[model samples]
Target: MGWRRSRSSEPHADLRLLIERFGWAVEHVRVPRRSTGTPSSYTVGLTAAGHPEIVVLGLPAPVAQDFLNAVAEQVRAGGSYRPGQRTGEFTDEDGPVVFLRVEDTGGLASARDVYGSVEALQLVWPDSTGRLPWQPGYRNAPGVQPLLGQVP
Candidate 1:
């Protein structure tokens, strides 16, 4: 059976089905370039499956969704990530992706709203030159990738 819809009119029925079948669901958020924030995506229901929810910042909505899905798939397959861990499993033209522990969940309101007080990680990808945002020669603008946690 489907869960009751929330006041915000989110697709609880669809999300429920997804979580039941896939162990989690990805929520892609697309923010306009002119907006104060950049595009991001996060996972829902991962905590229930014994894994921390995941988030990726500064990517296009589709790419972010795909990345989150890949991470979720790996998690379901028994792969795990920790803060400051770097893995080549998910990579761009530049290099491996890094995982950062989300010390603050304020930016993940949607994921929190779905699963209260869930632990989360941010998947940080490198720039064209394989430089992370904190490293020199990083390509993206400062606002493009707002880190939700401290750089490890």
Candidate 2:
């Protein structure tokens, strides 16, 4: 009954969905032209409200293009991260965006999973000593379904 996603149709679909649901002011920065050869990598940026930029670097041309598309989609959808939500905020304005970093892992296999079992949930604050925080388990609402799984 709530926002359940079947499997994602393409690579990075889930990431794009996350960005679409949670980012503000997403953009693609073009690589400078090189006379002798074409640029091999691209950069994509996403900024949530009250947070610094989250940059994805060294993306392949196709993926970079997809990032651009994701930006457009986010804009059209008017998506934004809400303040006070666990996964939404950074430790500070300059704190890390805590991306899934698709390039580091292989890719998103299904809509339900990220890098095996790592689902991007609300971000909890670090301990008093300043250690990095990790993602918490996600729960579906009573009348809502996750995009990946069926409700019983």
Candidate 3:
């Protein structure tokens, strides 16, 4: 069970469990924010009990604010693209935030099932206070779960 995570994301308790359970290789999970340009979406990968789950991680207060700011700029400028993927006048420091996507064999539905077990695992954050850092995901988003029924 091994996977990757982005360096800049963060995760909550339940999310952490799903990450560990699935053995995702990503460094972190990307949180969603209201984007003015293109419709913004986020996701995470999971593999619980040899299955995968795509639980959409929630946006933290600080992270969400940053994304919203970028969205505003894009809307006013008539731009399109996510803050992390876009640039020029309207861009967020947001890096390549890891997103849950469909795998070859399992697709994404299997990942969703893994998240369903998150509650039972009682996942814990790497930090004692459980407060995600500015870069986040590393301590929190690394284990965050994605919403899989549909990438809302």
Candidate 4:
């Protein structure tokens, strides 16, 4: 199927097209260090495929894109996940990553605008020393990887 650009003022025609073709689309937001927040990326359209959308914080745009893409692929292939679960599918070298329910959707404006009240999860990765953000001596700053949901 092909996507026709709608006349609405929404500027996500490209995102819609990508979702139609690939089951999901990744959106990477890069904020300068001087800004209030670090870089983040999220998936759009996963809700349409019967899966909750995903978000990754504090990673570079390219890395986040690849990570989200891999997750989307697995979800589309009948894989299931839940908040507080750990998996090594994405980063086996760094050990398993944790998934948490995103209680706040304010940062996922694109997914909300497209799907309207969609469920989302945060894929939290660990530091180089295999310590999660909640653990002591984690490398990144607090603001660098803000959690939008409760710790599981």
Task: Give the number of the best model, judged by lDDT.
Answer: 4
User: Could you estimate the TM-score for every candidate?
Assistant: 0.87, 0.23, 0.25, 0.89
* lDDT pick, better of 2 and 4: 4
Greater TM-score among 2 and 4 belongs to 4
lDDT of 1 by residue, 1-152 (tens): 22212244557666766788778877777677678877878888788878889988888767777788888888988888889998887785647888898888777776677777889899999888888899988888998788888898
State candidate 3's TM-score.
0.25
lDDT of all predictions, in order shown? 0.79, 0.32, 0.31, 0.84
- Provide C-alpha RMSD values for all models, in order: 4.0, 17.8, 17.3, 3.9
* Candidate 2 structure, TM-score to reference: 0.23
What ranking emerges by lDDT with the best candidate at the front? Answer: 4, 1, 2, 3
Deviation of model 2 at 23, angstroms: 15
What's the lDDT for residue 128 in model 2?
Answer: 32
Candidate with the greatest TM-score versus the true structure: 4
* Tens digits of lDDT, candidate 3, 8-77: 3543445455455543322223334554221222223323223222222344534433443333333335
lDDT of 4 at 73: 84
The digit string of per-residue lDDT tens for model 4 on 1-152 reads 22222345656887888888888888877787678878889999889988889999988877888888888889999987899999988885665788999998888888988988989999998888877899888887888788878888
Models sorted by TM-score, best on top: 4, 1, 3, 2
